[model samples]
Target chain A: MKASYTRLAAVLLMALASVALAADNDNHQVTVTVNDINELAVTGGDITLIISSATAGQNPNQATDNTCGLEWTVNTTNKKITVATNQSSFAHTLKVQAASVSGGTAAAEVTISDTAQDLVTGVATTLGTCTLNYRATATAAQGTQSVAHTITFTITAAS
Target chain B: MKRILPTLAATAAIFLSSLGQAADVAILNGDVSLTITTAAAGQQPPAVTDETGQLEWTTLVTDAVKKIIAQTNLAGPSYTLSVRAVNISAGDGTGAGAVVLSTTPADLVVDIPSGIQPLDPGTCTLRYAASATVTGGAGTDNHSVTFTITDQ
Candidate 1:
């Protein structure tokens, strides 16, 4: 009985010593999650406007003519474009138009109300094509000069 | 009896010393991240990796498709980013109006060579390819690709 008791004491002492000498366990975690990405791309890197010389009465005027058509594409929930000009004074009446949309979903279209509108009228994931047209008055500056206008396109998450 | 006790104590001391000799295991914690710095409808210019590296296209465009280049700052004995497994994890589905990415020309299997032992962080660049079939609707869309980075 005494020997059995000694063995039990030895076992308990070893257990306690093992616990004391054991290395502390350290733990850490790394979580990786991917977020939804929204992106926009245009075919042509930059846009160019070509204004040709016309007769005093046959200029590319807003009433009956439009020119400098550009094609752009979007791939986002929604897109809007705003037009501005560097010409402080109005020697010639300049008009900008979102010509039309093609190659997109049925809901895709162009909005041109002299303000910002969807690149493709509605929100969609389809790759649509849009034509941007600019019209200038016939009775403009006499000399062959150039004026700069800015066309800014914006992408949004809204439909 | 006294001799037996001393022997048992010696055995216990030996076992505890062995535990003390064991090395502590450790691991670096954080996220390994990759970002496409420049890409277009059918083009992937280059990508920046937060893992101390950058990625670029091996070939600018092959048959109207752009390649992807991946680089990282991970000091490696060896590094690898899987090719066949590289794919779009989220975004517009890869269906009719979806943009698909691959490591091959036929939109099939592409064998991108892994980085050998790179001395510097951004020295190695792994290339991948991309293709897109855009239909009607137009808007910006986000896409993601998950690739494993192995340093051995």
Candidate 2:
């Protein structure tokens, strides 16, 4: 009986020792992480647009350079233009009439276009006289977010 | 002795059963972190060509249809502006030349009467081909543009 008791004690001791030598595995979980970021910012200095008034018809007698008309251009031709908003979401405009314009508005049309699409107005671009339309919608680059959006504004007799 | 033997056997059985009880176990824990930084920039022309500039069409008028071609600046946070290029000369009547744009041609729906071709066609009418080489992740660089074109 004493021998049997000794063997049982030995067995219990061996089992207890086995449990103590295990791994300290009390910590392992998946965590979220952030990677790289590229910031694309825009400012007035980054863009260049020149729209002018040129008097064309009434100045028939004047030199061609002195003609009253709309002289405009986009300087940042290297970049692409997006609506940054949606069509009819928000609009920017300027009013030029026979009175404000050197020449009469007998033949005036609103011209709107970019690198891809062209928008035309058959009649003068008066608020009630004609409809001012533009496509406005914008999004930032993939994995990016856009803030402080901007839209375009203009008034010209180009169309 | 037999009763004692059975009692010892019960204890041995209990201990053996307890020893056989092992758990296939896994432990999991983790740490998370987040960071945020921002760098922004803008570029544009202070003012456009408000003053009259010379565009001598003598070089473009090879025929009556070849009048002039030019682009407007692609301004951002865009502003509204009018652009006109007009020059006259006594030339052949069988031909009618005009100014047009690659993006928004002035003569697309051109009117000989008003002479102002509406800005219609594309969003970015003017373009300046450019190229750049970026060195560091955080550094400042600068560039300027001067564009001239003549097309008949």
- Candidate 1, residues A33-118, lDDT tens digits: the string is 22222334433444444456555767553342333333333433454333444445434455555555553322233322335554
Per-candidate interface DockQ score: 0.07, 0.05
- B31-148, model 1: which lDDT tens digit per residue? 3333223334322222233332222111111112222222222222111222221232222012111213223212211232232112221112222222222221222222223322
- On the 0 to 100 scale, the lDDT of residue A106 in model 1 is 27
Q: DockQ score for model 1, please?
A: 0.07
lDDT score, candidate 2, position A159: 26
lDDT of 1: 0.35
Worst 10-residue stretch by lDDT in candidate 2 chain B? B120-129
**What lDDT does each candidate get?**
0.35, 0.26
**Model 2 agreement with the true structure over A58-81: per-residue lDDT tens digits:** 311211111122212222112211
State interface RMSD in Å for all models.
Answer: 9.8, 22.0
Instruction: Return the TM-score for each candidate structure.
Output: 0.37, 0.21
Candidate 2 regions with alpha-carbon error over 4 angstroms: A17-40, A43-46, A56-159, B1-10, B13-16, B27-152
On lDDT, the candidate that comes out on top is 1
For TM-score, the strongest prediction is 1
Give the per-residue lDDT of model 2 (tens digit) for B1-152.
74676576667656664543321111112221211122222112222222222222111112123223333323221122233433332231112232222224333112112111222111112211211111111221121111122122
